[model samples]
Target: MPYQIQSYFLEIKKANLQKLRKDIWSDTPVPAILQVGDTRNNIAICYRGSYTREFRKRSYMVKFMEPNTFSDAHVIHLNAEYRDPSLFRNKLSLDFFQDLGVLSPESHHVNLIRNGSLKGVYLQLESVDEIFLKKRGLPLGPIFYAVGNGANFSLYKKGKRKKSLTSGYTKAFGNESDDKYLIELVKQVNNTPLTDFPRIIFKLIDIEKYARWLAGAVCTMNNDGFTHNYALYRNSKTGLFELIPWDYDATWGRKVSGGIMEVDYVPIGGKKTNHLSFLLLQVPEFRTLYRNILEEILETKFTVPYLTNKITSLHQTLRPHILRDPYKKKEIELFDGETEVIFQFIHDRSAYLKKRLKYLKS
Candidate 1:
């Protein structure tokens, strides 16, 4: 069974409330108090995400200052889930990755109330910060958030529309000096030839782990994952980086903005020169590994029957809260329609991948 859904109440001062509302346009943290059922704590709350924060019911990042907050975790994430009406995209994606033996942030559902007003149902996720790395026994190294529209993992210099690789990362942990490793990784990807890539790529990162992460993103049709909304961390023990998926509310055959994506849409950067997918797909061995990983996921973890049950359970659990949500962005009827769309997407996507498997091998 999935974890039990939780409800939280927040009491924000009028002045702090005003600051938070303004801070949505700009990324800033405001001091506030948080109440979980009966327990109270001092926390710093901040508006998080790019386009999603602009919405009325915003997503947030919370830092619990005092110890023993939420079982030794200091930071947690609350996602507004406006784009994904089903409200289970993040949970389902994270669960799928774990089933495939990949590490991802754990997530659960929560009801948020501010100043006695119901803000709607939000997805509460474990933050991937220093505390998270410690709990996972991952080495304390540089942690980078792949942020912004220019976060496309391509070696593009700062130009009219693109931000350079150096400027694209927001370091959450470790020293700024560690960025030299990141710079070297980007150079190798952009400058190396396909034949030479295999011999040298493993020295910079773990190819097997990366292939699994890439497979997860492609199989789920998460168009944004290749570029943005990921966390890259270097392991102090191995001195290699691993990828963690983030902000998956846009997945399951939908764009980040909730637009419909075709079931047959291939997320591989087919001809794009700079993106990682473009470079990786060019290698025959890597291509075969990606295809095999996709087959494993579609066969075992991401099957239609399995995902259908997930959508059904989460819908039933979130229905009441979603309907009564005071700050819901869309009508309840539309949300109902979205649930059906999600169901059909799972079934259709499975069939589509089964057919496309032959082409991938060819």
Candidate 2:
């Protein structure tokens, strides 16, 4: 069965397009007109991603002009997903997080057309911001994107004291006041004594949500998720921080460059660089909760049979469009065989985690 995907057309002035191409590192957006099924709106678009900007098929960040939005989303990410041959890892990881009751971005595959030419299959992701909160009926709060390795919830980076506590985060939605909150949280995470860590940390962040988010990241084995590639949102009702995952293309047994990775590469506790996760797991209660979350997900959503069906469905839905996509023509074989790779990873990862669940008890 063929999956129907919405197509978006973008028209940019030749001069603006040239400028955008010339300055691939620029954060500034270029003016463009976007049309989808008779609705046209002025938008600003810019290249998105770090190393991915150098790829032949680049991703884009599209911001809708004020008072206009696409499906209630003021901004959207059109990811080339050039690194993932399967082109399903990011969507899979996000859906997995959602299934685990974690607040995650919603995504779907879409065909992007620029200057009357097909830019190929792109995963359209809902941006995490104030609008995301409103749509989900959640109270408005500060949202920050962990943009670099320094976002490891530590007071120091590379053995040096960070000049600013919030060095690695970009405030996606928040005021100057929010920075103090994040700074305080990081200070508590790193400065609080081990004996007093649990109580203080618990009050600063939602431990249960953090555990689940940690388990989700561990399960997907996202190499960069713990340190960065995540969003922190302060829950207005609870006044505690919660996590939202992002940039998960380098997951599911694949490295950022699409190379195969050992299933057990990421430890059950997650990367050691993330001080928050490391500190939380030190408490027996948090460890047990995280283990339980992983166990439940493994028995249910992360199982071979369950995920095989998912991978198969996604592969089938994407196969037709992917084969027709000019950008991915050279890697059709890898795309075709990606399901098996993912299935193998699931089997190995589940067994590895089940065996290691004992470590959490101590």
Candidate 3:
């Protein structure tokens, strides 16, 4: 057996899926549980809405296996040895994101056992406000587009509006009107050799826009964002953007060994010496802008406390599991200190960038 009984319970607290059944074949096909796109495990999304203040009055969309639901879904392989791991992973990813500052849809654990056999693991996630390209517009997508030198974002021709704002240095176009400003920023990010000497000192950086992005970055790392993960959002008709993160099973500062967090920071220095700082250097103008933004926000009473409380409150009941094997457990240890690490990181970043980008100011 990959793990004993008690070991399974602890792992159950932190993992995405629960242990259900092991068919003689890995593909025996249970009718209830299914794979979730978020975890690549068999799953389903059920009802989600709103209830409490903490969750921004939003209800979670759940992933579960209901009886007799598989025929409609594309059949996929499940672990022959146990329940789905997605049960534990998604919530953990949310907890981390909320604490770190990325806006994640609400996530909760769903316990459903057919006749008390512990049949399935369910993830209740927050419903995202999507401005469908065909119906509305996808402006908010570029908010998390990770714009910089050498970064590439796929342009959707069909849904995209396809009107240019700036040409030559970079091309800015969106499939819809809502996407106009967002796409303009991402597409026209290249350093423009201005005709008149950058008339305004803070003209290059939009503090508000970058603050929103910095908050989102904290959410990304907490979610253990993978290369493919993207924050999807919608710029509501009201104009305020609604952002939600959708990816997990990659974070929590846990490596199989917990040796160290091996983050590939943006490259910096020069042509010969590349570094993670290069990500900032690519947008040197933005550095202090966000610093000022962060400062202004911190002065207000609304920031930090909500995020701090959210992560702390959910740390125990909401921890997700990281499986050593798809169907088994070696047990990953939980570090409560992740919140402090993240906050300190953002604070230090604000301080550092303020000094670094001071040159851009008058």
Candidate 1 residue-wise lDDT, 44-68, digit = tens: 8888887777787788988887543
lDDT score at residue 117, model 2, on the 0-100 scale: 90
In terms of lDDT, the best-performing candidate is 2
List, residue by residue over 98-203, the lDDT tens digit for candidate 3.
Answer: 5445455554544333222443333433333332222233443323322222222212223443343211112121344545654444343323333321232124
lDDT score for candidate 1 against the true structure? 0.76
Best-to-worst lDDT order: 2, 1, 3
TM-score-wise, the better of 2 and 3 is 2
TM-score, per-candidate, Cα-based? 0.91, 0.98, 0.42
lDDT for model 2, please.
0.91
Q: Alpha-carbon error at 189 in model 3, in Å?
A: 3.9
Model 2 poorest 10 in a row by lDDT = 1-10
Give the poorly placed runs of model 2, Cα more than 4 Å off.
1-3
What residue runs in model 3 are displaced by over 4 Å at the alpha carbon? 1-103, 112-116, 119-122, 129-187, 190-210, 218-228, 232-243, 255-259, 262-285, 294-312, 318-362
Per-residue accuracy of model 2 over 297-343 as CA lDDT, tens digit each: 88998888887776888899888788878889778999999998998
Superposed Cα deviation of residue 102, candidate 1 (Å): 2.2
Q: Please, what is the whole-model Cα lDDT of each candidate in the order they appear?
A: 0.76, 0.91, 0.33
Clashes of 1: 0
The TM-score measured for candidate 3 stands at 0.42
